[model samples]
Target: MDDIRLLPATGLEGLIAQLRSRGYRVMGPTLRDDAIVTGEIRSASDLPQGVGDEQDPARYRLRKRDDGAYFGFAAPAQSSKPVFFPAEEVIWRGRRDTAVTPDSAASASTPDNAGNPTTAPASSPHDPGFTVERDQLDAPPIALLGVRSCDLRAVQIHDKVLAGRTYIDAHYVTRREATFVVAVACSDPAATCFCASMGTGPRPAATDPATGEPSYDLLLTEIAPSDPDRHHFVLEIGTEAGRDVAHAIDTAPAEFDDQHEALAVTAHAASQQTRRITAATVRDDLRASAESSRWEDVASRCLSCTNCTLVCPTCFCTTVEDVSDLTGATAERHRVWDSCFSEDFTYIHGGPTRESVKARYRQWITHKLSSWEDQFGMLGCVGCGRCIAWCPAGIDITEEAAALGRMRAGGVLPTGDHVPTGDHVTVTS
Candidate 1:
């Protein structure tokens, strides 16, 4: 680990100014219409300070925290995924045109006007009847502030799926490669969080923290209460770029001692309170429960609205379409984000294979907890709990998984020869 730097809390504004001067656009969380949103920010004042949010299925609202801590909150209702994989983008364009040409043999036999035989009248290829073009967008370099630890881990997971092997997403790579991440440790956790069990949460720890394997360029640990008079920020530079950014900011020297270490320990412990499952048996347990009937039980109340996938930090499935104007003179192909829970997601030549609601629900859970490892060498879920919190029916994934875990332990099947767990279970239509 490189030597830490202490920056005056107000120096964050100067940092943003420096980045902007270098032609980078800064993006951070800010209070917008009673909710925290991520967008272009020019200075520290544009950030959400001392504001928190309350999130539930189909409901999200901002709240004021008494401490006035800038980043004292859990993950927001939105994730930064859309900034890379936009909802819609043009992939290709084509045009329709008609032209006349003489036969090759006839043209060869013809002579120039000066000789004898006049050449066939030529046509301008550039003067096409129709044409289509893509809109060029110059994506400026971005610096993300106040990113949670779990979401930072989720970004790595997405990188594996999108650019890990032969399949490389050009769109994702363009944005990801140019962006800089500034991660902040989670000081507050929500009730549905289980990042601890997934081994990706609480505090941002590299997959191999002891080996000094760093995952972020900059890591900020909120050391103490914010004081307008004498504000302090403990900054850790994980990479060369991070050190440059820190050096550019005009701030005080950071003291690294036993006190700062103790503060980090306290923050980690506070994060663990919301976690129910421990690291043990999370992957294997969820995999073994794939064939169990608990899926059908959970699917009963599922509306298949796909809100969970949209708000999740790591979900990246998409679909493409070719469209043309009414005149059919020009056409364009576009790609857009998609969800597995939607009916059109599973459509095939014959029909949708996972037609039943129960099957759709089963596929989603099994994919996230079971098959994701086989595909990406990591668990699909970071346990941000967006899926649980955004389910309109209040279907809790952690609760459902817990019920399955109990069934697996007792050697009973959830669907056959077992009783339902609670009143939340409803009969399927």
Candidate 2:
């Protein structure tokens, strides 16, 4: 099979069938509860065809499209994180068992040890013993269809955070390794998208380091119809497995015109996006603007609801909990996704360290934009703008970063008559 091929829009059903025949549980975009979301998709008809989304600060709505194109929506309400790194998972389970032991008198009365028999006290049950077992995974191979570019980058970030050097999450590794990706280049970006500035997407660009191949097994770029009512996709095979699947379907080699139209699709999507941020310099500027008054202004509007962190694909904080049965014979431990916005998240010996909303808000954004680079060697945000559209108060991260930059250039500190002293900030009367 050629590396690049043109697949008619109808060919998508064949693609799904091929994956299922290979023992993959195919998941893709579908309309659920009035939103486009990922779910088990058996065929192209199961996808959210001819549907688009409208997104703005504190707003999201589903709209109709005249072009009957699948993969027409931007980022879904949920990212791929829930599939690999589950929101809640049981790590281990334990069971208690009882055993019997002979009393001292009973031992002395044994045939070999006792001369004359005194009535021996009945044997008693000894201390109960417990056995623990770690949860072992046996999930089926998963083929994720219709992944967007921003989300592809988000998955890469999750790999670094969960399966990196010092610590590795075994469950995440197991699921991630067993999954196959089918990424789609964005042709209809939402108003909230800023991946153009972040360099994460409108197009599929991630490459797997281990295999030196595109991160997706199969990448798709949908070109708008040249003919009034026809649509097709430019499919790029990125792995041997993808090539095998392509062989199962009838595809023609992509021509120069097909490739050109595909490029135009992604380019037009990038140009249509209204949001912007300088991803390269935001880290350094955020590190220096910790003392900026902008934190207070943002906090006043922030409910500390943790919506941003929950929607954020790169956020990895979690908490563990233990459960026991009524008889205390069975026990289980679970790891649940947690948020930095929770006051209890920062609880220390005294109390919650970040008691004020101001301090918590400062920590959340600073860690995401600045200190994340210090820890992970990359900024935490993928610029998907889920945080912006989902926030009830309409607080925008890009806007906050820009405000901080503007304040820094003016040499005006947030507090009155104050100036930064070398590496420290000082206040004056």
Candidate 3:
């Protein structure tokens, strides 16, 4: 690891300008209408500075903070995947036309006289022409600012699935490969986050250096108790590109050994506030409980709107369709996002594999918590709790999982099995 650099607040604007000048699109959190949204940002002024977000199930709002702290909040309502595999995309186009025949006179003139050894010229014949072309898209190099650590880890997991040896997603790789991640240490985490239990969290330990195989280029940690006039960022470079980008900013060398380590500990401690599920039995339990009564209870309140899958950072299922204009001359095939919660998602030649709402809900949860490990070598969920926080009915996944565990354990569920003890954790902000 390189020495930390002290960057003043104004240095942020310079960094944005540098990125834009290098032909890279700068995407970061910004205050939109009433919430923080990720989009193209041209300068530092575009950031959601001094603002915090209040997120709950089916709702998200922005609130003013006393301190003008930038990047001081939890995950946003939307994930960053849409930037790559968009919600909708055109896959192909087709046109229909009839074939044309050659002129009769010309054909007659092309007849050969075998006896006389004389042959006439061949006539030209027109045939139907159908052309198929793939859509050409280039993934521009992106500089992502203020990315939370959990989402950063999510990106890593996505790379493993999308760019793994077995199958490489051409679309995802084309757009996500060359991204420049500027990870922001979480100064404030939501009550719903359980990254600590997962061994990934608000702050990553410097001792466990990010593996260069798939590591962030730059990492930024905000020094707390910052005032409007005096703010500091502990910047560390992880790659050659990161070094180059850091050099562009007017900064001074600073020692962050103590502060950075303390922050990492604080972040880890904060993660304990979340309920922990024993991953040991999660897989077997999910497979065994596929037809359990707990699913029926969950499905009763589920609206089948598919909000959970949509907000999830890892769900990547999609569907395609073909549409033609009213004139019937032009047509296009499009690929769009889909969810297992939807009734049509399980459709087959005859009908859907899972007919009841209970079955669909069972499939989704089981896949996420259990089957995913067998399929991808990692859990599908990152414990972000977006599903619980965004579900219209306020359905808590941890609560439901605990309840099912009790049913499976002969009606004797372990107390505080997944609940936060409030002893190992502490929150400063």
- Please name the candidate that would achieve the greatest TM-score relative to the true structure: 2
Model 3: per-residue Cα lDDT at residue 373: 83
TM-scores, all models, native as reference: 0.84, 0.88, 0.83
lDDT of each: 0.70, 0.81, 0.70
Residues 150-260, candidate 2, lDDT per residue (tens digit)? 888888888888987588998898888767888999988887888888888888775844334468888898766434455788988888888878878977888777777
Model 1, runs deviating above 4 Å = 56-59, 98-137, 206-213, 226-230, 258-272, 414-418, 421-429
Checking candidate 2 for backbone clashes, the offending pairs are none
Candidate 1 on 10-110: residue-level lDDT in tens? 77788778778877777777777776667777888888877866655445667787765677667777766666667788877878764323342244445
Q: After superposition, how far is residue 363 of candidate 3 from its true place, in Å?
A: 1.5
True lDDT of residue 33, candidate 3: 80
**Which lDDT tens digits does candidate 3 get at residues 1-429?**
355677776788887888788778888887768866677788888888888776655556678877767786677766676766677888878775643344533455444667564565554544445566677776578878877766776776777777765878677787786788777777676666666665556665332223336356677777653576667677777677878888988777766573565377446546445565556677777767665667656777788889888888888888989897785566788888899998899899999998788788888888878898888777777767678778888666666665566557764333323323222222222
Off by over 4 Å in 2: 99-125, 206-213, 225-229, 416-429
Evaluated at residue 72, the lDDT of candidate 2 is 75
